[model samples]
Structure formats: structure tokens, C-alpha cells
Target: MDEKVLLGHGSGGTMMRRIIDEVFFDAYGGEELAAGNDAADLPLPAEGERLAYSTDSFVVTPHFFPGGDIGHLAVCGTVNDVATSGAAPKYLSCGFILEEGFPMEDLKRICQSMADVAKEAGVRIVTGDTKVVNRGHGDGVYINTSGVGFIPAGRVLGGQYCKPGDKVLVSGTLGDHGITIMSCREELSFRADLKSDAAPLNHLIAEVLEAAPHTRCFRDPTRGGLASTLNELAEQSGVDMVVDEMNVPVKDAVRGACEMLGYDVFQVANEGKMVCVVPAEESELALEAMRANEYGTDAAIIGEVLPCPDDRSPRVSIRTGFGSMRILDMLVGEQLPRIC
Candidate 1:
């Protein structure tokens, strides 16, 4: 109680139980969550509606940073993950791993942030778990979140839904989240301000679905940036992608950071944004829907799905601003490690 927590907290014994009961349970009070099970038995929604579920973990260093913190990141990450599946996010369960010596006030702040984000996203934090680790055994805090949502009937979205001539669109500027976290962790200074674009994107996805229900796929370019996400789409759909470098929106601050660090913005990570693939004919309509939303005011059409040049494997290609073309491969290993 004097210190934050020790390794015994994660031992799944008395210490862990105490942390869960005393801290987590006390913060998120409810009966559905009191069972303390790995998977919650959720009630079904009204007939004809389908359910969407998603899970994600956050390990961003410097738990507190510009634009957002681990609490917001954990909530939005899972909410967007479920939203990308073409669902209206409804509920979330959070798990926390705390390092010894961490401040209790910090833990309370993080929980409050989570609650605020959940309320804003129109979702609820139904249940959660907590554990602690030795001082040197863990970072300050790590959060894992899982979310559930309801998808309307007759609506289908998946990687396989992509086809030649589909359009690729991103909600707003790229690499903001990765660059912001990098600057804070490295203590880098710059003329222009940079902040993480961590946010809940369920609203944008929901709007796009309403305007154009035929979207092929929706994915947030996190961990592995835009290029990596396109690569995933190509591999999944067996179709190549042609992107225009000039069409992709990247903030000046982010570009500057990438240039100085020898990092590719397309290969960096993002938290609050999303990429949507829609049929070519409905691309304009989808753009309108996204642009109307605050999170996607700068939304742009960056590329199109096409028949792979190689008959065997699909890949992503970008027409550079210089008018040359280049293959956009997946980010090797970890592009920005420890970046949510």
C-alpha cells in the first residue's frame, strides 16, 4: 500500500488478488465485472444485429505524453479495433500491469482518463484486471483492452472484400502519434509543435458505413504505419495497391522528425487515425462522410487497389512526389518499438 506494487502482484496470488480487489474493482465498480473471468459472458443485442469484438495491448513509454496518455490509448485502441470491423463499439474491459514505486495518484488519473474516453466514445468499461511487478521487472504501466460492438445486419466488411479499383483513404495526417511519442521519449526539440493523434475512430467508421456500406476494409495504421497496413490489405485480398505520395497527408512536424531520424513516415505508427478501402464509385461519398467528422476533416484519397503486377504475390506501390514509383514493403522487425 505504501509503494505502488511489486512482482508478487502479477504472481496471480494474494498480491494480485489484493490489487484487483482493492484498486481495479474499486475504480470500476459493477457486478458483471465482479466475476473476475478472462472472458465475460455478454448478453446478446437485439435480434438481427451482429457482434464485433477486438483486443489490443499498449506499452507506450512515458505513459504520459503530449496529446494523450496510456489510458486514452488503451481505450481508443480497442474501440477503434472493434469499429474497424464495421461495428458500433459498446463495451470494453481493461487490464493493467503496474510497476512497483509507481504513484497511486498516477493510477487514479489513468483510470479517470479511461472513463472519460469511454464516455466520449459512447462505450462502457464493464470489467478489468490489475497486477503489479517488481521495480526493475516492468515499466511504469502497461494496459491491455478488449472491446465489443454491434454490427448492423446486411453489412459486411473484411480484407477479402477488397477488389481491384477500390479506393484507399486515410482519415487525416499520418505518423503524428509515433512522432509525438518519439520526440517526448528522446527529448527532441522542434520549431513546430507535434502531438500524438491518439483518439477513438469509431465515429468516422460508423459514418462511412452509413454513407457507403460496401467498404472493403478499415484498419488503423498503428505499430506498422500506412505502408504496412496497405501491405496487409494486399496480402489478404490478393490485389496490389497504387498510392500517390502527394495525396497522403503528413504534418510538417512529423515529416521533419522522420527526415531527421531517417525514418519513413509511411512506416511509422498512429493511434487515433484509420484507413478505409471503399469501392471506387463510392470513394467520393466516403470522403464526404469522413470529412464531415472532426477526426477526419483532412481525410484524403491516397490510392487505389489494382491487379498485382506479379501474378504470384500482391504488393503495395507508391507513385512518389517525384513522379517515380517504388514498392512499399512491410516494416522490417519493429519500426518504432514500444510504440502503441
Candidate 2:
């Protein structure tokens, strides 16, 4: 570890893992915290009870972007984290850090966005806090959200639950949110419409769980996109993953933008997407249920879990469109900074 922190520490890759293990976990970890799932599954005061809890901070630049703004991102980010643990997100608490001289109108717009998304997701913003910093000390605004949700009985989902023969599925297209932010940040002009796929995914996930009760795990591919998210799950489950590149969906506009900008769509960020793992036998049923939901119309089975090869660590590989296979590793550094 270095004497001070670097932006790479927040990139959700190797550095982030080191910092968590050496700093946060070293100082505050317990049995439950050490598990390091997206959300903490805590036992309620009453017997035979558990709840999912998660917190996240958003610092996306430009604040407002195509399809959604920071406010919408903040709510969906936390809600999806809790929901990924197979919980029904119910309540959230928001905290705001505002730079001095920030516009009141913009703040009102953000608050309204939060309210609207909360209502749509069936979650409530029950409490919050606000702080102000000097004009140059902070961005125009940064938002932190914490959420709690109830885990339904018989719903035990975690990355470690995956095993060989399980199938991998992704919700909708990739790189929409990241490409939208990149286009806005760089002021890139394109004829095709590009928008962030930012929306609450709790409802879509609920439908999938109902149809595929034997689902092994759920993960929202946020910071490091689908590649990193799948790699993490593969390592956690001690299994290898073989993904079909042709089956993975990427919007034409987004793909073009990524090519023009030298960005890998698989390594970009997404606000309203999830990677689901379920038994191979239930893959088709899970796909059907996901497609029935508005947010998951593009859901597809992209891969399958495989037993780890002898003398090698668990990893992820993609079968390219050209009949070649390549290893897909986690993002080494920040691809698009301030992306949620």
C-alpha cells in the first residue's frame, strides 16, 4: 500500500481490493463484513430474520446526462445493490455534499429526480443529510445513498453459490451508461441517439427470481461493467466462465462510440443492468421472465460456468465473433472516472 490514496483505488479492480483488505477490512471488518458481498445480510432483532443493507456514493461529472442525471443514478445505484442480494429494496437515506455557490434550481431538480425514481422503484427516501464545502473544495454536488431491504425467505443468492453448469445472463445492452457519459463529457457529436440506460432494476429482478427460484447469484454490473463483475463472481465461485461474444448485446451506437474512443464496451459502466447466474436447466425460463419485464427486454444467456482447469486459477474467457477465444480480465485502471 502507498502512503496516500490514488484514484485507482476507487476503480473497483485490483487496487480497490487491496485498499479494502488492508484498510477498511483491516480496521472495521467482522465475520459478516468479511464476506464482502454487495450488501450485508444482517440478522434482524427478531428470530429467523435477515435484511440487506448497502451504501454507495455517486460523483459522476456533468451531473446531468442523457437518459438520466446524478440524482437518478444515486437512487438506482443503492437500490440495485440491495436488490442484487435478492432483497426487496424498501427504504433509502441520502446525503448530499454541495460546493458553495451551487445553483438552488439544480439542487431542486436533483431532489425531484430522486423522488420520482424512489416512487417508481417502490422505495422511500426516509432520511438524509446535507453538507457544504468551499467553492473549489468539492464538485458542484456529490450524493451518497444508503439503502435497506427485506430478504425474502428461501431466497439465498450470492456469488459463491454459483457452480459448474450454471448459466450467466445479462440484462439489456452493455455500455449505454458509460458511452452516454463519455459522449456528454467530451461533447462528441453523433447522428444516432445515445442515452444512459439508468433505471431501477428491482422489479425486473423480482420477476426473474419468481421464475427461476433456483437462481444462484445476481450482480449489477456497475463500476467495472460486465467483464469485471463476471470475473469477480467467477473467482468467488471457484469456477471458470466461458462467455459467447455473439450473444452479448451491445447497442450499435454505443459500440461505435466505444470504437471511436478506444473504449472496451465490456469494461465500461452501466447503471441499470444485472448479471444473473442460474442452473443451466432454468436458463430459458429465466430469460423468458426477464424479457417480460420492461428493463430486461434485451436479456440474454451469454455464458456458462465451467469447472476450474487444473493448475490454473478461476477466470473468464470470451469466445470472439471470429471464432477465437480471449481472456477477459478486470479493468486495470479507471476507464471512465466519475462514472457512478
Query: Candidate 1 — number of clashing residue pairs?
Result: 1
| lDDT per residue as tens, model 1, 1-340 | 5355666777879877776676666665566768667766777788989989889988888898888899989999999999998899998988887887888768777877887788889987887777777788778899999999998887788877789989999999999999988888889986239888999999889899889878888999998899889999889998999999999999988898899999999999999889999999999999999999999998999999998766479989999999999999899887678888
Model 1 CA deviation exceeding 4 Å by range: 1-3, 6-31, 34-41
Worst 10 residues of 1 by lDDT: 1-10
lDDT, model 1, position 165: 89
The candidate 2 region of ten consecutive residues with least summed lDDT is 23-32
Query: Across residues 1-340, which tens digit of lDDT does each residue of candidate 2 receive?
Result: 6543444544568876765566434433455546666654544434444799999999999899988999999999999999999899987877777776666557667777887898899987655555657668888889999999888766799999899999999989999999989888888886248989999999988999989989998999988999999999999989999999999999999889889989888999999998999999999999999999999999999999999987999999999999899999999988999988
Off by over 4 Å in 2: 1-47
Q: After superposition on all CA atoms, what RMSD does each candidate show versus the true structure?
A: 2.3, 10.7
TM of each candidate vs. truth: 0.92, 0.86
